[model samples]
Target chain A: MKQSITLGSVTRFIGLAGFLETIKNVFTGKLDKEDFKNIFRKVIMPLASVLLFFAVWYLSANKLHEIEADHLINKALVEQGPAEAEKLRACIASGDKSCQPNALPSPVQVWGAYQTLLADHYVISADKKAFKKKTASLNAKRIANGEKPITYTGRPSFVDQIFTSIITVFAGFLLALFIAVPIGIVIGLSHTLRSSVNWLIQIFKPVSPVVWFLLVFMIVKTFTKNSSSDSAFIICFISVGLCSMWATLVNTAMGVSSVDKDYINVAKVLKLGPMQKVFKVILPSSLPLIFTGLRITLSVAWMVLIAIELLAQSPGLGLFVWEEFQNGANDSNSKIIAAMFVIGLIGFMLDRIMLTIQKMVSFNKND
Target chain B: MSYLELKNIYKTYGEGDNTTEVLYNINLTIEEGEFVAIVGFTGSGKTTLVNLINGLLEPTKGEVLFKGEPIVGTSHERGVIFQNYSLLPWLTVGQNVYMAVKEAFPKKSKSELNTIVSEYVAMVNLSHAINKRPKELSGGMRQRVAVARALAMKPEMIIMDEPLGALDALTRVNLQDEILNIWGKEKRTALLITNDVDEGIYMADRIIPLRPGPNATLGPEFKIDIERPRDKTEMNDNPNFKKTRNAIIEYLMEIGNERKSEVQKEYILPDLAPKSFVW
Candidate 1:
C-alpha cells in the first residue's frame, strides 16, 4: 500500500486543519468570504492585540520615566538651588547613567533583561562544568576515602531559580496528592465521616499560604533544628502542599460520593470486595472529577509556591524576585518584569499539561 | 424447596410520621427452572421488590430465602440485570462481562475468563463492539452489554428489573427474543419485572401484577401457556398468548383504576367567556 501524507492528513495531525485550510485558501486566491473573516478573527486579531499591548506598555513606561525625571529635577532645585538643579538637568540631558529614573521598565528593556538572564545562565553553566572537571579526580578520591567531596557554593542563576521553583511546586503537588486522596476517599465513602470532617476542611481551605508557611516553619524548624540539612525547602514545600490540597480534597470527596448509584449497584450485584470495588469500579467512574480536582490542586500549588518560597527563604524564583526588588539596580525593574512574564507563561503551561492529562484519562470526550 | 422465596416482604422508607410504605405484604415464590415476571405501573415498587430479591435491600417485615437459606447479601449465584443498564462507563463491553465473570469464577484462568467473556458478547451479537466503552455504544448496545455481563457470570438465577424499558420498540422486541433464547437454553430460574404486559407474557412462564402504591402488593398471577420457541408474528393469533396478555393487562388496569379513584377529586370550573377584540 502506498502511504501518502495528504495536506488534510497533515493538518489534522497538527490539530490546526481549519486554520491551515483558511491559510491555504488565501494563498490559492480561492478563500471564502467567511473563511477570510474567520482568519482575521482567529489569527490576526490575537497578534494585533499583543502588539497593541506592547505599544501601550511602551508609552506608559516612557511617561512614567519623564514624570520621575521631572520630579527629581524639581527636588534638586528645591533642596540644593539652581546650580545643582542645572547640574542635574545637564546630567539628565547628557543621557548619563547616574541620572536615569528607577521606574517601570520598557518592553525593549525587559526583552534585553531576558536575554541577559539567558546569557548569565550560559556563563554559570560553563563555570559549573569547569568546576566539575577540576574536581572530578578529587571527588573520586574523596569517595574512595569515604569522605565528603568539596561542593560548589556558587549562587544560582535566573534559569536555576526557575527550575528550583518548578521542582518545589512538583514536590508540593505530590505531597498534596498523597495526603488528600486517601483522606478524601475515606471521607467520601461514609456520610458520617464526610460530615465530621466537613468543618475541618472548611476552616483550613481558606487559610492563606503565608500563614501555612509560618506554621510549617515553626514545626519544621523545631523538628530539624539539630540536622545539617537546611529546612527551608521542607518548610516551603509543606506550606505549599497544605495551602493547595484543599481543592483536591473537596473535589475528590465530591467525586467519590457522587458516583452514579447504578455503578454502585453493579458493584454490589457483582459482589466485589471493598478494595476491588473502589479500584475497579468506583475510582474509574469518579476519575474525571478526581482529575478536575488534581488539575485545580496543581495550579493552586504553583500559584502559592512563590509566596511560600519567599517566606521560607528558599532559593527559587520568589527569592530571586525579592532580591531584585531589594537590589534596586537600573535594570532590576526590567528583570522583575521578565520574571513576571515567565511566571505567568509557566502557570499557563502547567494548566495546559494538567488539562491534557485529564482529557486522556476521562471517558467524557465532550469535556 | 423453592429456588427463591419472599415471604410477607414489607419495605418502608423514613420513620415515624414521615414513614411511607412502599411495598406491603409482598409475597412471592419461584420453583426451580421457573421464569416469573412481576408486571406493574411505573413507580409501583417493582424495583424495591427486585432489590429485595437481589439482596441489595432488606425487607422490613419478612425474609428472602434462596435455596431454603436466608439471603444475607449479594451473591454471584443470582445475577441482576438492572433497568438502567448499569454498565460502568469506563469499562469496555468485554471488560464489563469479564469483571463479573472473574468475580463469579475466581478460580478460572485468565484465558478461560476471556473465552467466557467473548462467548457472551458474541451471544448478544455484539462481537464487533466488544472493545468499545458503554458511552460509545448506543442504548441498545449498552443494554446488550448489561445482559452479557449478567449472563457471563453463569448465575443459577437471572433477575431483570424492567431491562428493556428504555429501548425503542424494535430493539425491545429483538432483546426480548435474545433473552428468551438464552433463558430457554439453560432454563435458569428467572424473575423479570416489567410494565409491558405483552413483554411479560412473551418472555416469562408466569406473569404477576404489582398493584400501585402507597402500599403495593403482588396481585393475581397469569400463567403463560404459549409453547416453547414462540414465534412473535404467530403470537397475535395464538389464543393462549392473547388470553394471558389480556388477563394481565386487565388486572393491571383494574388496580390502576382503583388507585386513580382513591386519589380522584372533582373541581368546579368558573363560567367565563373570552372577550372578542378586533385588531
Candidate 2:
C-alpha cells in the first residue's frame, strides 16, 4: 500500500512534467524507484507491446518461408523424374527460377520495400523538377511568338499521390460544408421545408460513392470529352462531396430545429434582425451539433475519396494501391501493405485533428 | 397615453381541433414608471399575457399598444426577462449581456459596450462570474444574469415572465428585493409575472390576478399600498399587508375551486335548442 502511494505520487508528478518524463524514460539516467516505475508504466509499456507485435510477425513470416520452400520443391519433383529433379534442386539451391518467392515478406523485407518506394519518389521528383524547367523555357519561347504556353504533364510519384488524396478530400469537405449548412438552416427553421427535404435526404443518403462517381462521371464525360486533362480530379472530388454531404445536412437541420425555444424567445425579445438572429442566437447555440456533423462529414469524405479516385483513374493513393496490386511482383505486394498502413495513419491523423477542433469549440465539458 | 396597454387582447394556440384558447380579453394598461405584477396560478396564461405585451405572439383579436402605437412585432424598446433565464449557454455572462447592449446601441465603441455590460453585471452582483458561462452558474446566478442582460438593454419597458418562479424560497426573496432595488433606481415601466402572491405584493405597486385558463382572463386588481423599503418581517406585523394579502388569497382560492368545478357536461353543448326550429 505504501509503495502504491509512492508510485501514485511519482505518476502525478510525471503527468505534470510530461515531456520531461518521456526524455527520462528514454535515457539511462539516475532516478528514484517510484519515478522509474511511473515512467516504465506510462511510456515504455505501450512501446513494449508494439515490439512484441513485431516479434510475432517475424516468427509468422519464417513459417510462410518454410511453406513456400516446400511448395516449390514439390512442384519441381512432381513435374520431373529423379535425375531432372536433382538438377532442378541444384538450380533452386542456387536461387534460380524454380524457387518460389516468399509469400509473406518478413519485417525487414517490408522495410526494404518502403525504402525502395521512398528512393523511387526522390528520383521521380527530381525528374519532375527538370521537366518543369524545360517546359518553362519552351513555354516562354512559345509565348514570345504569341503561341499558347504548353502544359507539362508528368507521372505522379507515391508521395505525390498521397498529397493528391489529401487535397482532394479537403476540397470535397469544404464543398460539403458550403452546401449543407445553409440548406440545413433553411430546412430547420421551416417545418414544411423540413418535411419536403426529408424525402430527398432519405433517398440519396444511402447511395454508394461508387454509384455517385459513375453518375457524375457520365455527366462530366461529355463536357470534358474535348479537354480531358485533370477533369478526373474535378469529377472525383465532386462525387466525394455529393456522397459525404448527407450527414452534415441531416445533422445541421436537426441541430437548428432543436435549438431551445427559450433561445428563440430571447432572440425575439431582443428583436434581433433576421441576419442577427441567425448569426447571434441560432448558429452559436447549434455549433456543437454542427461541429459533430462536420467531423463525421470530413471522415466520410476521406473514406469515399479512395473509391472515387479509383473510379476516376485519378492520381491518388487509391490508384497507387490498385496499380501495385495488379502488378503482383515480388516487392509490389509488400508495397501494397505499406500503402494500407499509410492510408490508415492519415485517416487517424485527420480524425485526431477534428476531435481537437471539436473539443475546442464545444460548450459542454463532458462532450 | 398609457405607457403600455393590452386592448382586449386574445390569444389562441394551434389550429383546428387542437386549438387552446390560452388568454381571453386581457385588457390592461400601465402608466409610465408604474410597476405592475400579474399574479396567476400555474398554466394560467401569464406567460402568454407577457408575450402579447412584448409582441412575441400577436393577439388573435385586439392589440398590444406601446406609447399609443399598436405593437406589430418584437422591438428593442420592450426588453424581456424570460422564466428560463435564456442566456446562451455558449456565451459568457458578460458576452450574453453584450449581445443585447450591442444590439440596443450598435454605434457604441467596444470599450463602451464592455463598460455597459460589466456595469449591469455588477448591478446583479455577479462581477466575479462575468466571464463565466451560464451553465457554470447556479439557478439564482443564472437568473441574475438574465435580469442584468434585460436591464442592460436600457429599453423603455421591461417585461418579466415568471422570472423568479423557479428559484428557491430564500433565493426568491433575495432576488425579489434585488429586482425591486434595481427597479427603484430608474423606475422603468416594469411588469412582473408570478404565481406567488407575496412575491407580487412585495415587488409591484399593483397586483392583478389572471383567472385560470382554457380561456383565462384577468380577475380584480389589488394595490400593494405598503410603503417603500418594506421589510418581510415588518410587513407581517403591519395591518395593511395582512389585509391586502388576505383579500388576494381569498380571491385566488375562490377561483381555484371555481376552476375545479368546471360544470363541463352541463354547459358544453345545448341539449335541445331553445326553439322548435330544429323540427
Candidate 3:
C-alpha cells in the first residue's frame, strides 16, 4: 500500500541535507555546539533526575511498608500484657497449643483502622436519622456535664490547623515587613542613626524568641486576668515577629547605605527626584543584599515561631507535635515523625516560594 | 562674553592640622559650542575642576557661571559621562537612555521619547544592544550606552571625564571619532578631561594642559584650528597639528623631567636612629 525509498537513498538524502545546513551555518558563523549542549545539560538532565528520584521513592515505599509490618508485629509481641506473656511462656514450656499470644495487626489492618478513623471523623453522614441521634446524644452528654448543649458540628481538622499556621505566619511576616523595611531604610541612610541603633540591635538580635515569648506571656498575664488561648497565641506571634525582624532591618539598611556613590552621582547628574532615586536606583541596586536579608529573616522567623509555640503552648504545627508527644498514643512516634515531615516540607516550600519571588524581582544583569 | 566661566576658583581639603589646597585661583572661559579638552597628569586637579563645574563638589572660593548665571548644583542642563560607565546595571541600554530622555522631556509622549532614545542609541552604533543590560555589554559598549544616555537628554553641555580612557586603543580611536561626529552635528558645548595629548588634540577645539600640583593650575592653552571630519592620517601629516602635538608633548616632558628631579631633590629618609645602628 506504500511506496518506500531504499535505506541507502534516504541516508544519502539526509546526509546531503545535513551537510548543506552545516555549510550554511558555518558561513554565517552560527555554528554553536555549546548552545545545544547547554540546553541538554541545564534543562533536560535536571528534569530526568527529578523523575528518576520519584520513581525510586515510589518503589522503595512499597518495600518499606513490608518491613514496617514486620517491625510492628515484633513490637506488639514484646509489648503484650503480663498475663499474655505468662500464658505464652507456659505454652512454650508445656508444649501446649491453648496458650497462644494474640496475633499482631497486619499493615492492612492498621490501614483499615486509619481509614475507619478518617471516615468517622471526616465524612458527613447522609442519613438524617443517624445524624440526629448522634447529635442528640452528644448534646445530652454536654447538658449532663452542666454545660449548654453544643449544636455546632464543625470541628477543627488537620487542614484547618495548617491554614491557621499559614495565616498566622503571613500575618506576623507582613507586620514584620511593614515595620522592618522602613526602619531599615532610615537606619541604612544615616550613619549616626545606624551607629546608635547598632547596640540596641546587637542586644536584641541574640536574645532567644523563647525568652521573648515567656516575657510576653508574663506581660499578657499581668494585663489580662483571664487571657484566652488566642491571646497567648498572639503574644507568641508578636514575640517571634519582633525578635526575628532585626536581621532584615540591619541588612536592608546596610545594603541601602552601601550602594555605590557613583550611582548616586549619576542620579544627581540625571536630576532624579528623591522618590525616583530611591525606587529606581538605590533599591534595585541593593536588591541582592536585601533579598539575602529577607531570606534570612524568613527562615529565622520560622525557627522562632516553632520555638515560641513549643515554649508557649501556642496553636501551630509546633503545638501539634508537643501535644502528640504528651498524649503518648500507641502510634505517637509515627505521629511525631509525620508532623516533623510536614514541618520540614512546609519550611522547604516556604523557602522555595521565597526563592521564586527573589528570582522574579532580581534585576542582576548577568542573571 | 563666555558661554561658561570659572572665576578665581579655590578648593581646599580639611582645616587647621590637615589643611591642604587642591585648586588655587583657577579662572577659565569656554565659548558656546566649543569642545575644550583639559589635559593633565594624574592628581593635577583636572577632575576637581570638572566636578566643580558640574556642581558635584563646591569650590572653596569663586563661582562657576553658565550663560552668565552662577552654577549652583547638578542640573539636567549639564549632563555628565563618567570614565567608568555609570549606566545602571539593572536597566537595558535603551531603558537607560530612555530614563534620561524621559527626565528631560517629562511631558513628551512615550512614542516621542522612545524615538529620541533609539536615535541616540543608533548614533552611538548601539541600536543592536538596546535591550541588553550593562553587564551583558563589553566595556566599550557600556561606554557607548553611557554616551547615548547623556546625548539623549540633549543637555546644553556634556562633561566627559576621560570617557574613552579606559577603552582599548582601537575602541578608543573609534569612539573618539564617533564622539567628534556626534559633537560636530549637535554642536553642544563639551568639556573633556584627559591625560592623552593626542586624544586632546584629536577631539578638542582647544587643549589646556594642567600643570602638576600641590596647587595645580592650567598651563598654556593650544588652539587646534584643524577642520572637522579630520582624517587621523592626514592630521598627523599637517605641520600645525604636528607642531601643536609636539609642543604639548614637550611641555609635558619638561614637567615630567622636572618632577623627576624634584622628587630626587626632595627625597629624604625619616631619620629613624640611623637604621637602628645594626652592628
Best by DockQ: 1
lDDT of 3 by residue, A1-367 (tens): 2748775444443334443444455568774787456546655576689788656755665566446544544555689855655555555456342432223233443354445434543553334346667789888888899997855454444444556677667766776777888898888878999999889888888887878887777787777776543585677677777877877888899899999888999888888899999998998888877777777777777767776777877677777667767876554434555556566777776766676567656766244
Clashes (N, CA, C under 3 Å) per candidate = 0, 0, 0
CA RMSD per model (angstroms): 4.3, 8.3, 10.5
The DockQ of predicted model 1 stands at: 0.73
lDDT string, candidate 1, B1-279, tens digits: 788988998999999999999999988899999999898899999999999999999888999999999998898989899989988878888888999999999999999999999999999999999988888888999999999999999999999999999999999999999998899898899999999888888888888889987789989888888887888899899988877777777777788888888778667789899989979
Clashing residue pairs found in predicted model 3: none
True contacts kept of each: 0.91, 0.85, 0.76
- Which ten contiguous residues of candidate 2 chain A have the minimum total lDDT? A8-17
DockQ for each candidate? 0.73, 0.54, 0.60
Candidate 3 residue-wise lDDT, B106-199, digit = tens? 9999999999998999999988888887888899999999988888899999999989889999999999999898888889999999999999
Q: Is candidate 1 or candidate 2 better by TM-score?
A: 1
Q: Of models 1 and 3, which has the larger lDDT?
A: 1
- Sorting all predicted structures by lDDT, with the top scorer first, yields 1, 2, 3
TM-score, structure 3 vs. true: 0.75
For residues A89-182, could you state the per-residue lDDT of candidate 1 as single tens digits? 8898897867787999899999999999999999999999999999999999999999999887798999999999999999999999999998
Provide the lowest-lDDT 10-residue window in model 2 chain B. Answer: B262-271
